[model samples]
Target: MNRRYVVHVDIDAFFASVEVLLDPSLKGKPVIVGGLPHERGVASTCSYEARKYGVRSGMPLRKCFQLCPRGTFVRGNYRVYEAFSEKFFRVLHSYTPDVEEASLDEAYLDLTRCRPLYPSFTAAARDMKCRVEKEMGITVSVGAAPNKIMAKLATRMAKPAGFFEVPAGGEENFLRGLDISDLPGIGPKAQVVLRMLNVQRIGDLWGLPRPTLRSLFGMGGEEIYLQSRGIDARPIVTRSKPKSVSRETTFLQDLWDERLLLAHLAYLCDRLTLALREDHLYAHVIEVKARYSDFRTEIKRRLVVMPLQEMGKIYKIAEELFRELFASSRLALRLVGVKAAELVKSRPLALFEPYSERQERLGQALDRVRGKYGFGSILTVRERMLDSVYDFEPRRGFILKTASLTK
Candidate 1:
């Protein structure tokens, strides 16, 4: 049987490391990248020193400062990070054409075909890590295994700047001693539930019957059981486009009035529609997501046979869905979101019949103006209402405007 080899590469403390590279003085000090403490923002990433001080990613800025008063805090620069990621991927491409980017800071490379190119998997991993650190001024950790699951687990075991290899046929042994949380798909809730079922380790899960596990956690339990034994059949797909475009907001204080909620939904639909138009795409499905004070969440979706491009049309559908889903509920809302799915490339000019050439021209003109001046250059009345309600401001960046049309 032919063996499959997978390699996982993850940059160490990506944002914090970039900060260190820019300023030599911050090398050994505790560094934090997040928003201002007064703003309700959370830490994006922090240095190992900051972790020692009990500061972690996703912690509120105020708590981070309370834990480490002297920690250096810097606002995250996403553009710089994006540039670094591009350069890093270039180096990865040099090693294998079968590289799959897991995220901005992590990637997986299939080395089954190129195993003979290097003396061994360990050597290949070492060389890759060295090239990234030397060329990009960033450290990376690598993990090698016969499958993606084992490769991911190996990477976690070799954290804080190191490399590890799980030898062929040794995956189960490698995972046997690890905590249940070490499994990729197991979250805190799953861990608690598993503990209640008297399963404390990854090995313990292997003994449970698949049906019993499925009964407890549904389809996800079956997935976890397979993963526990390093049996992930998911391939690294090259092109994975998003099924939907969405925007969401969580209120610091919950709102109770139905009118106010409807207004917010209108604002979200406007934003989502603008994004859809910018992408040169239209959606046939509109989904509205709402979270109540009791932590219960609901999503209601409606499908249209014809793709919708107008903000008014999309918002009307979303409002109707929301009203139908929450008509009797009087609970305060914690969060609200709007999503557009079932997308297709916009056909401004059609062959089957004559369409509204004037509407298409207007959309193109508005998109050009927004592209040049920024998203705030063009806004509907609903977005203006959002500004009044939330004091929102648009940032300067590549808004998905006319750019998509050219592509």
Candidate 2:
């Protein structure tokens, strides 16, 4: 059997790096993205300089501010970062067709088949890394190993524009002495148990049999057993189509106003439909969720005869679902959400008069505009009310999250 060669590539501080590219003056400074320090939101990303001060992504904006008072906080433009992500993926595709995108800033590439095209895996990985930086103006850290687990671990070892490799026979040596947390799925709770078991490092677990580990951790035990031995049989493949897509948010306060809730629902539906069209799929089922101020949750779902792709059609069904949930309860609402499910790749074409061709054309045009300008570029009148309620960016729309800040 041919030994598998997997390489993991990750952009260093993706959001902060993109911000520096946008404003060269911000380079070398501690730049934080998400919202301003005084704002009530989590830090999306921060530069290494900010990291040194203990400012990390997902940390509260207030805490981040306390850590790096000199840092520049930005209400980041995701549309801009998304644009760069396209270029980043394009670079990977040029190297190999077998690529798995883990996120906007990270991917795994299978280079075993492409070995004949270059002198070695290392050379191809180097060329791919250089091309990504050259095309996107951002540095990426990479790691290569005989399998995916070791490759991911190696990449963790190589950060902020660095590369490391674990040769075919060296996986065991590479994983030795690493912290137990370095292993995937090892959490604080698991650490307590592992510590009691006297397995402090990856190498320490080498003594335990697979059956023993399985009994200790259930179904995931096999994964832990194999990963600790530097073996990961997972293949690098393109992502499968999602079973469903959803977008929702918790209100800043319990809302009793139906108009305000519907307005926010329209915004969420727009975002959800944008995602549906991006994947070239349509939903046969539409679902809406509402969480009342009393913490009771209600949901309503409808299956349409004709699957939906256009925002107008999807929003229509979603509106009905929301109304159903709203009318069923008299309590104030704390959260609202929309979900699209039972997806199919082929969007149903509107061939009859009831579904006008003009409406189809208009939906296409609107999607094109949003694709180029961003989701916030075109908002319904109802969605416009969100402009005054939340911090609005012309093309990026409102920053939706669990907590909201009064505009």
Candidate 3:
């Protein structure tokens, strides 16, 4: 009876670390990668050095400036980050074909089937960490355990550049003393509810009766109960494709201006279409969403007769949806989002007969240039409207890390 083993690998301060690796002069210093500290954005990643000053990812750039005034801030380059991410995943694939990417900077590899290839799972994990650091010039932490829950938790425990493992039978002992908040599913709201019940630790949750937990949290309580006891039966899915790809931004201040909203929508559509083309996917459905200053939200969607991948087509639909959805209230909005769904791997040429092949060719050409230079190297006039408000280079999504930029 061989035990299953899952390995979770996370790049240390990925965006920030990449910055330091590119420029050794920035190494050992506080690096912030999202944007300038005063910009209307948040930290994407920060070096461990900056963490000492309470600077963290998702913290407002203004607040991060007040916390770590001396920190070096840089607008991150996503293409460079994407390159590094590809290298990182390539290394994982060398060890196991059953690797699951959790994000651009983290992944889970099922080592149960590969145990015979390596002397031990611990050795395999250590070798991976070493190779990543040696080859990529960036450090990573790895966690190995019987399940994904414990594996990810193990990775978190081994931060900076370290490795940790929990033997098959030691799961309960390993999880017992940890805080309830340490579990992946425990959000702030869950924590508030648990704290009210005097449940401060994972061990505490383990001792509660199932009915009591269910009565308090419904189906979520059952999940809390299972996870608290280190019971995750989910398998490593190596081939799961994303259901959708979307991007959204929250304004530093709410705005009623229509032009600015359209500009932002166009930019977001460009980003979404770029990603769709990169993955060789197309969307049959497009959605536009907006959140008002009062927190009221609205969404409008359209189903296209043919799946679309061109940015111009996607943006045009998004613009229509936005106008139609907001035509009545046109409330001042604090946030706006665009999403492409009902994705398909490929579309037939006949389906695109009504659309412009020239535009599609143009999109492919633009992607090639951007792939070589970087995202937003050539911006559309609509996207350029963001220039007045954004000082950092534009990309598909929000900026959240602070690092030194190259070129």
Candidate 4:
């Protein structure tokens, strides 16, 4: 059996760093990437300079401005971010085939089998970091340890372009002094519960009896116990396919008109299907969700016989589900969402399908045109209504804070 080692690589302030790389004038300034201060979104990421003023990822742009008034705000560009993420992953793939992309800027590589090829694990990690900096103009912090949990924790300790490694059997010593919150799966809510028990450090939690901890936290306590002992058995999964793709929007004001809802659903379906086509995958399930002004929410799903990648088919199902769900008690809605699930790794291969061969070819043609131009270049009448409801500047590609972990 292989010696089970994982290497975690994290780009430092990825979104902000890319912005700086594009415009060197913003290098040393407090750069915040998400949207303008008055916009209805949060910071996707911010520079270390912005961190000095207590700004952080997911902080509301308004609040970030309140904290760092002098910071440069950018409406984030996902195309550029995705390009950088590709470069980041390529660097990791050069070292090991078993690399798991934790997020757009974080990855875990199982270098256990390839360790013998390098002089030492640290040397391999340093080479990865230097190559990333030199080739991509981005710095990465790397951590090497026995398993994924310790590797991730080590990366946290070695942030801002640093490297650290823990030999096999030294996981406990490396993690014992760290905060309980630093452990994976330990969130703010878990921290409060642990603090009530005076378990502040990972070392402190390791001293508690498993049953007592289990009584307090149920299954999560068992997980904490194992993690405190640096026991993580999960393997690195390479190029893992996403189980589902979804798009959602929260309204600035509650909306009650069905036409407006349909328009929004149309745009959501278009975006979701575009993503599906991009991944070269199809969805066997379609789902729609809506939240009313009074806080009532409902989600409806439909199972399909054949996987689908066409926008019309997806939108039709989502719209029908939405109508069926809200037909009776349609109130002012604050949010709406569309999702594609039960994904498979290929286009529908059946002899005959819901769409004709010509229709499929047209869909592919439209996708190619949109890819060259922009999402707004080709849109249905209903999707065009999105412009009136919510300024749909397709080139601007708005993204919210989807990453919770630090890079």
Candidate 5:
């Protein structure tokens, strides 16, 4: 049988690394990108230097500052990150067209066909890292294995800036001594659950019967079993669409006013609708989530007869759901989220009805104006009201201009 090989590549401390690229002096110094000490946000990413002080991504910004007072903090620049990501992918495409982008900083490439192009898999992996670092001024680590799960695990073993290849038929040996969390899809919550059952290592996961594992993890257990033994049947999908699109906010202060909550929902719906139009997709299901002051959460959803593309229509449905399921008065809400699921490519022909055509024209016009001038050059009344809630940085213009051209 022809063995499949997967290569996982992840950029090192992506946002923090970009800061270092702009200022070489910050290379060895601890760097963090996220909110300020007084801000109600979390760290997006932190340098390894900062990690030494126990600073890590997703940790609250206030906590990070307490941990590493001397660390430099910079607000994240998504546009700059996106620009760098394009150049990064261009280099990867040179090696293989079969690439699956796991996120902004990580991807899995299928290089089985190009194995003979280089002297060895390790050499090809090294060359890939070198090309990215030399061309983009960014460092990446690579992990190679016979399948995606193993490749992902291999990358964990080869952290910071390194590369490693798991030998074919050595998947079991490669996973034997690793913690359960070393396997992909095993998150902190899953690890805690597994530990409760006295399963601490990847090897221990294999000792449990498949049926029992399934009972423990539901559908996810079968995936864990296959992955623990290095048996990933999932192919590298190049063009898989997003399962859902969502917009959410963590309130700086918990809110109770119905008018304020509605205003925020309007803003989120507009943002979500704009995203759907940009992706040329539409959603048939809308979901709303509310997290109370005590962190108690409730979700409400409704399915539409037809996929929707208009912001007004989506917002109306979301507003109705909010009113029906949530206490409208005197309820402290810590978070609000809007999600659109059951996506499909928006069909132009199907959108020829009068209402749909008008929405399509409006969206196209707005996009054209934004493309020519800029994103903030055009905005709805509701968006302007909520703009102050979002983080603002003046340097964002430079980053946006640079990324738009490259993308």
Candidate 6:
């Protein structure tokens, strides 16, 4: 039988490194990507030079500025980042079919079946990492071990352009002396609790009874207990579609006007369906959210018998939900939102299906135009009211953050 081997690859400071690669002038400088320091947003990633000033991903740009005032800040271009991610994944897929995309910058590969072709697991991982760096002009850290947990941790151990491998029987030795804080699931709170218990190292956690660990961390404790001993049975999950996609915005002022609210709903639904169709996914569950002026929030959701990808169908259902929710109390709203969930791939059409073929074609047409001209180039007559509300820019869409997790 072949031995199990999982290789984890992580791009080092992916966004920051890409910025440096795009413009060599950024090299050796403290680069922070995500937003300008004067802007209202968080840092997506930063160069190691920025890290010296305590900068980090998800830290507010204002606070990041306070830490590294001289840092070069960039309002990152996600489309470029995504293009690089596509090339990065292609390199991983060249190695094995079983590649799990952990995020845009990281992936896990099951290379056990292909072991016979390589001199050693480490050699195969190193070659793959080197190819990514050479092709993408980005540094990558790699890890190889018998299980997923150890493999990922090994990558963290060998970060900033390095490689580490744990042979089949060496998981315990590889994990033993690592700091508890270095473990993925052990957050700051866990570290405090563990420090109080004198469990400062991965090896220290291994000696504690499983039940004690379980009592400390609840259901996740079992995972922590197993991970401490370099045991992880989680399979490589490679699903590219997310479980849900949503778009929402808070009004600058409370709104009692129903027509304007519907306009907002239509806009949000349009954005949501565009994301769904891009991924070749459909959703059977539709949800609508509304927050009244007094801080009361409400939502209405339904599960359909059949799934759909067309925006009109989704908006019709969403409109129904919003009307019902709005009529329930007829109060002014501070925010409105829409969500599509229970995602699945679109099924092949059967002969003379009962679905709306025209709506489907319309959505396809809209998607094609949006692909070239931009999403806001054309909007439904209903949603056009937004032009009067905000400083509308068809190509760039206004300054509203839809809280859109497009992926």
- TM-score of decoy 2: 0.62
Q: Which stretches of candidate 4 lie over 4 Å from their true place?
A: 240-407
Model 1 regions lying over 4 Å from their true place: 240-407
Q: Clashes per prediction?
A: 0, 0, 12, 0, 0, 0
Q: Model 5: runs farther than 4 Å from truth?
A: 185-193, 240-407
Poorly placed runs, candidate 3 (over 4 Å) = 240-407
The digit string of per-residue lDDT tens for model 2 on 1-407 reads: 89988999999999999999999999999999999988986888898888999889989899999988889999999999999998899889988888888789999999888878767888888888888988898889999998767888889888979989889999888888998889864645568899999899999988989789868864346547766777655556466656689998877789988888888888888888778767877776688999998887878886443467777767776777788788878889988999987677754543311355676677778888877887678789989887656666656568644344422
CA lDDT, every model vs. true structure = 0.77, 0.81, 0.81, 0.80, 0.77, 0.82
Error of 3 at 43 (Å): 0.7
lDDT of 3 by residue, 67-132 (tens): 999999999999999999999999999999888876899999998888679887888888988998
Candidate 5 per-residue lDDT over residues 1-407, each given as its tens digit: 88877899999999999999999999899999996777877899999999999999989899999999999988878999999988888888899888877678899999888767866777787888899989988788889998777887788888988898898999899888899977654645568999998999899988888789768765356557767777754556575667689988767678777766787787678668878988988775688988888776778775443467788778877887787556543468888889998677755233222345777798889778766776657666765554544432232221212222101
Kindly report the root-mean-square deviation of model 4 from the true structure over all alpha carbons: 13.9
| Residue-by-residue lDDT tens digits, candidate 1, 34-127 | 8766556789899999999999997989999999999899898999999999999999988878787877899989887786687776788789
Query: Which candidate, 1 or 6, has the higher TM-score?
Result: 1
Sorted by lDDT (best first), the order is 6, 3, 2, 4, 5, 1
State TM-scores per candidate.
Answer: 0.63, 0.62, 0.63, 0.62, 0.62, 0.60
Q: How high is the lDDT of residue 141 in model 4?
A: 87
Stretch of 10 with least lDDT, candidate 4? 398-407
Error of 2 at 198 (Å): 2.4
- Summarize candidate 4's per-residue lDDT along 1-407 as a digit string, tens digits: 55677889999999999999999999899999999999977898999999999999979899999999999999989998999999888877999888888789999988778866876877887888899889899788888888877888888888889998888889878877888888754646679998998989989997889888768865456567777888766556555657689998887678888887898788788888888878877886689999989876778886553567888878877887888777856588888999997677766644323346776687889889877777677889986665554443456432223421110
